[model samples]
Target: MTKPLTDQVVLVTGGGRGLGAAIATAFAREGARVAINYLKNKGKAEALAKDLGPNALAIKCDVRATDNVASMVREVTETLGAPTTLVHNALADYSFNGDGRDDLKTLTPDHLTSQFETAAIGGLNTIKAVRPGMEEAGFGRIITIGSNLVQNPVVPYHDYTAAKSALLALTRTAAVELGPLGITVNMVSGGLLRTTDASAGTPEAVFDMIADNTPLRRVTTPAEAADSVLFFASPWGRAVTGQNLIVDGGLVFG
Candidate 1:
């Protein structure tokens, strides 16, 4: 029995845990060889690769560094074949506790720069490294994990939201250029996820409030958001590019 993504190879950054892990799992389940990229979570990444069987590999690399990203892509290509799909899901260390976050008054340029370095610059590094391979293969899928907060900003996670907003601009611009080479770049943004490492610090009451406001009456899960990523990589999204799919159960419609 042939699977939809049989023979496909996918590289997911920050894939050791949380939503990255979920997205990697989804791709592996779809019969694609998966490479899980992580910065400091080796144990979790290795465990996931083991659980996902021979089709998965965990590689460590900081996406913020161009050399690191390029090296990681080389390793993935050598081990799993050149990745035809790339998911830029790596995020900087951030806690969702509103009390812990820097508000506009206290937020400094360093804080914003750190987020931009990880979310936007990191994305560029990875894309540049793997794009050549995708061009050679004449097929590619680039899915960026974003936040619905970029549009809603209900919580005003200023730095995080601002970084994602920059990512959206990059996504759209890349889509325009890559679409001609069989590469489709798109984004999947979700509201405060039920429980990701970044969102774990969020208050339970906050989650309930978001759920109450959503049409589905529930906060979206990492797995649910991950499925939307599959759509961009699947044949169904062959013609779709430069699109942002909000997967927060109808919380923010665009």
Candidate 2:
């Protein structure tokens, strides 16, 4: 049997660690050439590439910078071939410690902007950088990592949730525009993934509460969420576009 992504090239931003790392590994497992993009964690990214063997490469680029993003994509194309799949998983530095989070009143515009720059604008940059290649190839898979909080907002994470919400809108709009180009743009929203770096600061009680509320009685895993991403890139999702797949163990419907 042929691999689902054989001969495919994938670029995963912020793939140095955590959820991004898991996504990159999943793609590598599926026989895709993987480019792991990192901002500051060169050591971790290189290690992951090495672990993934010859099919993976470690690249350093700040996703929020358009020039850097363009350069990164160009390098990935030259090294691994023009990416047929792009996963925008880069995130601004944030800890999921609700008690220590900035309340609504204390939330500044800069804080929101920072999150938007990394989450929304960073995705925009990657999409733009890869659009030409995808359009020329007439096949593309664009997956943005989102949060289930946009649907439930249970934690009131003002900046992060707001930025992801905006990303959802962009995903839909891009889907409509890119669909005709034979490219599918979608999002995979996972809730409180177990043990990701972003969620490491979450209290144990909060995790317990989330697990109790979910139908599966457990939080989603990054590897599990990564599977959904693979779906969009696979032939199985050929006709699916502009949709969000919530992988939070039934915590949020639709």
Candidate 3:
């Protein structure tokens, strides 16, 4: 196929499994050196790296910890080269249970804080870690994985949705500030990805409902979501930034 990302180093946080893994593999397939960052899944990360061949590196990092993020970036830069594309796909805690999806009446500070820490703060830390290299190269692509729950608010994942909304705002703000440096920030928001560990706890009825409602009549796959992210990183999207591309099979149209 095409090697648009040839000689480029791409870091994907939380890339051991699920959506992150898909994105990492996609980057590697396109000829970018891939750094797969995982907080706990070292085995899986290493496996993915090996599968991706010589250009892939696996690094353990908790994005919530700025020091860890910095070190992870340093290692990747030293080993793989300076990262021109950073995909902030790390999530601290992800649960699909009904308990965490309560409305405002039942929302707790802990719930809000945890979500923000993972989705917003984690993204900020990852970006900060790689930004200097991107600046020096005069090119960068920051693609944050978001959720369609932020737009439609279907099942009341209040804290999660709110955190993603904050991330989207950060994406826009970063785009504006980094545009002068030829860096672009964007978000790819997907809905109810099917068969991932993160969605294992979701009720079957919920999945059924979403599939029925979505125009495509099916839940998304991690691979499908990864395509949107690849678009942002590709040369085709050089002039596109500060935008959220909803890839929910046309679930939320506006």
In model 3, how large is the Cα lDDT of residue 100?
47
Model 1, span 1-254: residue lDDT tens? 11157778999999999999999999998889999999999999999999999989999999999999999999999999998999999999999998788888999999999999999999999999999999988888999989888888877789999999999999999999998888999999988887999999999998998899889999999999999999988887888899999999998989
TM-score (C-alpha, index-matched) for candidate 1: 0.97
Show the colliding residue pairs in model 3: none
Better of 2 and 3 by lDDT: 2
Instruction: List runs of model 1 lying over 4 Å from the truth.
Output: 1-3
Q: Could you give candidate 2's per-residue lDDT for residues 1-254 as a string of tens digits?
A: 11259878999999999999999999999899999999989999999999999989999999999999999999999999999999999999999999999997899999999999999999999999999999998889999999999999888999999999999999999999999999999999999989888899999999999899999999888899999999999999888999999999999998
Per-prediction TM-score to the true structure, in the order listed: 0.97, 0.98, 0.95
Task: Tell how far residue 247 is off in model 1, in angstroms.
Answer: 0.4
Any residue pairs clashing in model 2, and if so which? none
**lDDT of model 3 at residue 205?**
89
lDDT of predicted model 2: 0.93
**Clash totals for all models, in order?**
0, 0, 0
Residue 9, model 2: Cα distance from true site in angstroms: 0.4
